[model samples]
Target: MSRARSHRWLRRPNGDTTPRFAYGADYNPDQWPREVWHEDIRLMREAGVNVVSLAIFSWARIQPTEDTWDFGWLDEIMDLLHEGGIGVDLATATASPPPWLTTAHPEILPVTASGETVWPGARQHWRPTSPVFREHALRLVTTMAERYAGHPALVAWHISNELGCHNIYDYSDDAARAFRDWLRARYGDLDALNSAWGTAFWSQRYSDFEQVLPPRLAASHPNPTQQLDFKRFSSDALKQYLVAEREVLTRITPDVPVTTNFMVMGETKGMNYADWAAEVDFVSNDHYVLPGPQSLDELSFSANLTGNIAGGRPWFLMEHSTSAVNWQPINRAKLRGELARDSLLHVAHGADAVCFFQWRQSAAGAEKYHSAMVPHAGADSAVFRAVSALGATLRDLAPAAGAPRRPARAALLFDWESWWASEQDSHPTSRLRYRQEALDWYSAFLALGVRADIVPRGAALEGYDLVVAPVLHVLPAELAKELTAYVEGGGHLVTTYFSGIVDENDHAWLGGYPGPLRDLLGIRIEEFAPLLDDETVTLDNGATGTLWTDEITLTAPDVEVLATYTSGAQAGRPAITRRPAGPGSAAYVSTRLGAQGLTPVLARLLAAAGIGSELPEEARGHVELAVRGDGDTEFWFLVNRTDEPVRLPGVTGDVLSGPTGGGTADDPLVLHPRGVTVLRRPAGR
Candidate 1:
């Protein structure tokens, strides 16, 4: 039998001419007085919020006791929303369980790797493997699905809130047992498991399945391999939870899409989005851009990654603060035009819909200060006006903006397992950070106005002309094979410090520093020394910089040095080098460099690979370019994300701009800040 479709994802149902645009914010009428429901609906309609995500944290009200469920309030709320012509993205109400449920079934609560049982207060506090939690949670979802499966306003089913809470994996006895079962099913034999884990080194062999325990803070070894295994296990455990919940929801509403919101690039949680993609219908993520120009690169990189996760499928901007977030160390409102700019950028990249974390600001709670469409001051506030303006724009531009677009010829490999393993290592340089390093490379590209895709290391490497893998610590054997093949097949590959150290199981590769990639990279690492103090590295090729000191030897005869360490004993040695594999070339950097030091080298490589940084020579300066292609048409978006007024380029006339004109190749067009222009070209150039 074919698998059931996830109901919380986007689906082009009935081939409707009016494309489905989920222009809505999260709603929690449970907290508001009953008298206010009508006003809220009216306000939502005014703001063009056609959909509202409801019941995200309503488990407490729905199941006051294990045997009793109260649906009277929910029925009224659903009816009200339906009457208002708003679609419903119904949440499973499993984000947080009620205090009574936890008190009655304590086993359902999650235990951290540190042995602390995560209590009932926070969201994502449930244990995935717990029978009680699964039984109770499934019942809730099943009942809701069955009741609302054919509801006119129901558009999708949100399975649960963010999968892993503070951290990934629960080390409860139940979780441990479930993990062992998962491993047994995956490897099929104890010998294979032992070999994969390299159990002989630390005498950590498991005599029986019962001896296995979930990787925990107490039992975790400093060994990179063990730590990496723990990371993988944690990711799998969390994925299993999502799959279980998805299975239940799909059974009830197979026609609708299903999804869960992801926190972008969070490392401590151990959720690898790529691993979760196959199970989800499409991906949705929360974009919480830090409040400053400094965070722009991070925000763009995250947006790029989210786009790639859905395989270029349009994703929902599930939750962003409409004004300011309450939880950050210093919460501040987004400057007047900043929020709109950020949201537009998401669309410029790959987002199909934009929504805020909340519809109304909370009056009492930890999130009371969190921004919302309507603040505590009510519907007449300035924040509400801003929201209303955005809604109006979305409604007007929905037809044009909702269509998809693909980016240009850049690709960055994001390996969550490698990130987890690299950090788990006890001996690697303490300065090494997985996400930060990846972000650094990504930022370099974005700063130069180069559009890139953030792909998993295992994604198909053929389409990309430039593949950059920075700090790829744990190289999955399959990915290693693909990388080698890609480089040998004439693609340019760039990798940096502390890469290829571990295998899939997170065990150190015994052969050399870059164990699996040593042959592919044509280098041998003789010794790795930590740079305890500040130092500089100068390349023989005129590039000079400071880097954590490490001495490496070139094993490949064809390799050529690019940069050398300046101060340490490894000074004048190759800090960076390139070698030809087959049809293409491979570049390796032995140490990390700041953005200034890295960007020039990256530009050189990109240029050498024949990738164009500048847009068509005829294009104007102020017009930022983004391109996405379907079968026969290439959609190009020219957006002015900057604050000042600017001119449009070439010929573009859609609803965004009032009229169309094909100017001479030399003529330039001007556009105001926050203006967007989309142009289309037929396929076959």
Candidate 2:
């Protein structure tokens, strides 16, 4: 069943015998006049929209009151969409419960860490552990599944939109009980729980399971183990909700593919999407371009991560903006051609579809200021023109949807447990950001036009020449063994400070820092001298360290220093170390390198590993290069994000977009500012 579902992921089922690649937006037909419904579909058909995600937040309108349902309007909405040759990714409409249900069962609402009850001014207010919430939510899912089981327009089932986006961790009494039960299932006994949480140190040992509670209103950073379990419980609790909804979905609409939109932006460590990927038929994600300097890099990083999450298969680009957003303090509009640039960038990674937030602009509600496909300026607007043009552009390249992403030669080990543990309070420094530290390395590879997949810690390390694990604060012994084996088998490794220092329960490894990896890295840390935010230290080898610095001493004869601190109390100590391990070598950096310093450090590592730049010096920083292939055909998608044109040398292929008759020996591909060119070639090259 999983294999069959995987086959249906990259494209619509072949049985449809129609044009593929879903292109549309979230449709809220209830927001418009009944007379405006036909015009909405007409404009959709005109804009080349073949898919519409219907009824994402219509629970109130659909149910209205207890013991009542109005499927009459939904019936017309589905029929009209099908009549216009548009497929429906029908939603369960359970994201936001109606006011009636919340008022009737107020206990279902979530409570924050400070004990404030979260009311229903916004969406997703119900507590996942509340039986009142669960009963009503499951009933809604069952009803929707049964009603749309055989509807001709129903192509997929979207379950509980963006599960746990607004309310991930609730500190309510219900959640406390649920957390205790989850702990019991994990630890099996109170004694095991007490030991794992290390209750003896804090005099907080529990004698009974009922004594446990969510880590809340703590005096000073509650037990780190309790914090870790709460994160785990929160993730698992949401997954349980998805499982319940899936049970109803498959029981009725067994044939309809099921999925939920995942908000998988950078550093979003609340929910581990790697585990959630297994619970769905096909992976789908919603990404909003971060409004800042590294926005483009972030978009690429997240899209690559999403594709990797889907296991190299093309996933859905469920939601993005056509222009400005409403949430950020300084909402900025997309520059000319930025929309097409952003959308195609996802496709270059592995998006089988191009979608947005809404079909029409909203004149009311919190999100009314958010951009849409059809702007308030009407279909004749420039934003609408760009959306229409992107639709036609994507529809022409439908054959590339099912191809796999080219295998990465380097892997960045991304661990969710580390992300949780690193941010715990009372750490060495609050400046140790998990995502930024990761993006620092990831951006280096991106800037050099080299592609690397963000892999989980447990993934096989046999495929890559180099593996990088940054800020691996808590290391399980099994993973430690795996890293050792990876280096012994001739794979290069790079790890940072505060790694291999503890077990999974936040218990420090006894004897010294980097306990299990000491021999591999050939270094010992006696103490840490974390620098203040404004302090900076230079290295003897021309690199600079900031944010963190550790006092290091060589423990092995073969260990070599790559950099040494030339300032502060830890002066003359090794800041970076390298040592040979069997067939390959392992390197460690004991302090965060400055932005300019990482370039040279990464250069030395890449050169040592025999991994070279993917593009020429001319094309290195000028373009974004990504490859997707199967064994017969390969596609090289080059996107030029800058304002200047980029010239590609020795490039000839079936140019998806360019002059007539495609590429020839006489002409090389040249991408204009913010332009995208997808060139196809034989895999034999």
Query: Which whole-number lDDT from 0 to 100 does residue 652 have in model 1?
Result: 41
The candidate maximizing lDDT is: 2
Global lDDT of each model? 0.74, 0.84
Poorest stretch of ten by lDDT in candidate 1: 652-661
lDDT of 2 by residue, 578-678 (tens): 89887788999888874356767877888888887766567776688888889989987888868887777666678775322333336657788888888
Off by over 4 Å in 2: 1-7, 10-14, 17-19, 658-666
Q: What is the lDDT of residue 149 in candidate 2?
A: 84
For all predictions, the C-alpha RMSD in Å is 3.0, 2.0
Which ten contiguous residues of candidate 2 have the minimum total lDDT?
Answer: 1-10
